[model samples]
Target: MATLFDEPQKFPLAERLRPQTLAQYQGQAHLVGKNGVISKLLQSDKVPSMILWGPPGVGKTTLARLIGNHVKTPFFTLSAINSGVKEVRQVIEKAKTRAGSILFIDEIHRFNKAQQDALLGAVETGLITLIGATTENPSFEVISALQSRCQIYILQPLSPETLVEMLENAQKQDEWLKKLNIKLKETEALLNLSGGDARRLLNLFELVVSAFPANQDPLVITNEWVLSTAQQKTVRYDKTGEQHYDIVSAFIKSIRGSDPNAAVYWLARMIEGGEDPKFIARRLVISASEDIGNANPTALVIATNCFQAVTMVGYPEAEIILAQATTYLAASAKSNASYMSIKKAKELVRKKGDLPIPLHLRNAPTQLMREQGYGKGYQYAHDYPHNFSPQEYLPEAIAHTTLYDPGQNARENELRKRLKNLWQDKYGY
Candidate 1:
């Protein structure tokens, strides 16, 4: 077993154990099971452009490779981090001659608008089939035009059973592990550390095994042993990995929960971890409107200015601005009234689609529309007392619908009073 660790030096345990076939793959049964969408797609042999959206180390890259192999297509790989529009153009230029080629981009969300736009012509036309993998949500990260052309598949985290199976298999199948005769007495530490990532699970297993004596036959593994061995090895926070989302989640939840102390602490955690100042600033803007709203209108203003200020002043100075905004928002009066109002309004619109607008509320743009009684009985709010026209602006079918309910805060209480006095009993105020 002298070359046990040395043999797999080039290819890590995760890469070596990557699922070669759909049957060999663990987890995401909904996507690749007997009746899965991917199975059906493969049966028909009609592979379209797709974006695989999931967390890190969940076989996104592996699945992309498997798809290329199964379809017998020329597959090209690119990293959005180092590759830009120029590299993208080079791939496209080459893909022109090879029709039905597959171009897989790892961390596809990192591509900016211009870089994504470069792929539009090729994707729109059938020159190349794009397979984009990203950890971020495609709706927020990908350009709508490009996203519209690709089917998005979500890969879920590996289950505990699947993860355990993977570790056990790696130990038995690997030539080096067999030689070491490692005894896996317990796996709680490895599973907990993996955080449902299959690649991380295998990596942790390998690391723990390598630390033991070279000639130690029956190298026993246990929760306590693994934790102690790997604790000194692994980094607690990864800015580009799963820990990035966890810390940000804690930060946002602290703000929403109105704990300034926790909010500021989480903010420090982010800044220390090298998180993007703009990202923190953007969340601050969203939190202001979403959590504080009209309960403290100035909160939104402060957050907006914080975003602008951070954009201008980065790093050490930007941390100060972020902390200020985060604390102020956490301490402010909280309300989701405005956010809920829009959500309810959109839901109604979707459920009762294209509900005809009352002619009075509709704009009289042409003579024909005017003759059709558009704006015939429209009452201008400015012409009435208190600048409030007590007419139903919503369509007659959904008249008297109350969308905006003011929050029970000092500022919104005044708004509630004004609305109640104006609408009277008609709006149930």
Candidate 2:
């Protein structure tokens, strides 16, 4: 049916496999399934203005299209990169006359605050059902009023299983793929290279298929081929792109993993690629608090000082401070005990709602407060021996909440030994 002379297509898979209905879309079962919010809204025909946030190739755009299709309303689309506020106003004007209209804006985060504000009126007045898609966090990029008016739903990266299922489905369904006698010898290569991006996976799949020499029976796709083909020199690592996060992640992991050599390499990669030195320093600050933690209390102090010095000094000069902090963090003993402990404590506090403060711990600055027994049983540690008084800080209901479990590193060992002496029953160091 298909000829060899056919021209290579720009969006072969994405366009062909574009889900015309919610049922055809893969992944995001949370929003499109039977009990999903989007499904319920569609059934009742109550389409609301909303924002979709997600990583690349997560069907954010496709889901927006699917919603537009199912809603029985006029739909218009705009790309924030090329469109200005003028285009936004034009769409709004059109939507004013057309009742129950949807205006979808892709990369809505790229729109500046002013451009985004232009949409607020149309969205608030129901002139258009706003469907905004953003790869960035809306809290950071979107205006407060605009964000408040739109319900935000985060779309997740396609699972490895879902990605593999898509590839297998394409192989079975695509005439060109089947005609080529394609056999995926290894999926690890594809999955690794795609980084869980479905569009990237399908594009790579198409590439491997097309690269196979003519007359080769049962064309096998191997890791070596995938690696070689996908080995593209990344364009000047833009901190705004996914590679930015990936490289920063590698840099931090290298430091956390105690590989100063790899850490410096990633650091250089980011710096030479024009990453903000302050941004790098900020991550170091966090790495110091999170990974290096109580293993080296000096780490937090050093990183904090570095951040301050870098902020005052600026780049080129600031780079030295970053390097100094990075090296120290890389060479330091690592511990995440404090980080995990606080995270767990915060999670409990959030889940259990606002818990009452311990009566003894509360301040009795007023006479009426003292009458309520506030600070009645409070102990003055400074007045006690060794300037240490064993007392409960958490609420009585959460008295047993064992947060901040220090690790067994040298610095924490000192804390562990001292704490055990003060509170023998608790803090099983």
Candidate 3:
């Protein structure tokens, strides 16, 4: 008995179908399961400030909302991208009248230090229980002081079982979808496109369904049809979530592989997708050292400068700078020696506990320590030719264990020659 709409008007399928209670929610059983930590806390009605870290659409926001609803207190929500310090203060002020209130901030990592600091006093005083959701790792993106006040719970990607179950439930639960008699004959293509994200899966399912005519009752959804229909959508690439990381990985690998053409191509793809310039710039800085390394020392300097320039100039012009850095790094000599060296060095330290520093390498500032022969045999490199004393700098137990084997590049070749002359095969350089 519904009248036809003159214009398209409705919430997204994801929103319309969002679970209002924990019973209807799927996935993230680790947190919502019977023996789960969050479940126990909710059972006790003890709500603490928490951060839910996960990839896109795995129920961070949904979980936060459910917790707020379960708490039976004043619930407020804000998006860090648009909400600032003033907005945060306003929420806190409003929550003052309601004790044990819950405030959920979606993409909380987007809030800068000052804005995050604004929530500290309210949270510290127990005025508002904060449920923050972030796609980025909290250790890197969150301020330490704020992070110290909150417990971080990692949400895993939705399993294939959970995703399929959602699809099955949607057809039976949604009024419009139920009438469509949607039959998912094949879901591999649809799930693959979702990348284990629940919201994406629901929205994508909506898109695929909308592609068919209304009269197409008992509509059959096949992998081939889903693929063909989805490919026809306006958006070519996803700018967030797993696809974002994949695109970034491709961009970095292209530069490391020394394909300037491909590197620039990937860089253009990221720029066109409205990627954060600073994020792309950061990857360039990492690639400069991790991929280019000492093989082209200037690559690091140029990349660092590129990051600075991009942060200052931003967009339109920043793309040109990113392109310059990307191509230069791709064209430059490549080496992982520096990257491998630290990795091997850390492994050695873990294998070999705190070994005593060689007596000569130990500091002898005090007269009593000097009597123990701390600096007795230590040779000062300044007095030696080429500033190379050729003494064991490492602990005696692991002496001469080669960690840095220069790459097979022109610059590293020179390094290999110099190391060979200095150690004379001592380090096997």
Q: Identify the candidate with maximal lDDT.
A: 3
Per residue, candidate 2 scores C-alpha lDDT tens digits across 290-387 of: 99899998999999899889879987888788888898899999999999998998998988878899889899999999999999999998999999
lDDT of each: 0.87, 0.83, 0.88
Candidate 3 per-residue lDDT, tens place, 1-429, comes to 222222242887889888899998888888999888999999999989999999888999999999988989999999987899999999999998986689999989889999999999999989999999998889868899999999999999889999999999888988777766678999999898887778889988988888776555767899998889888542455665446766788899999899999999988888888887888888899899999899999999999999999989999999999999999999999999999999999999999989999999889999999999998899999999999898999998999899998999999999999999999978987
What TM-score goes with each of the models?
A: 0.83, 0.79, 0.84
Please give, for residues 291-312, the per-residue lDDT of candidate 1 as tens digits: 8899999999999999999989
- TM-score rank, highest first? 3, 1, 2
In candidate 1, which residue pairs clash? none
How high is the lDDT of residue 90 in model 2?
Answer: 93
Better by lDDT, candidate 3 or 1? 3
User: Candidate 3 at 84: error in angstroms?
Assistant: 1.8
Alpha-carbon runs more than 4 Å astray in model 1: 1-10, 157-191, 209-223, 233-235, 345-356, 364-376, 395-403
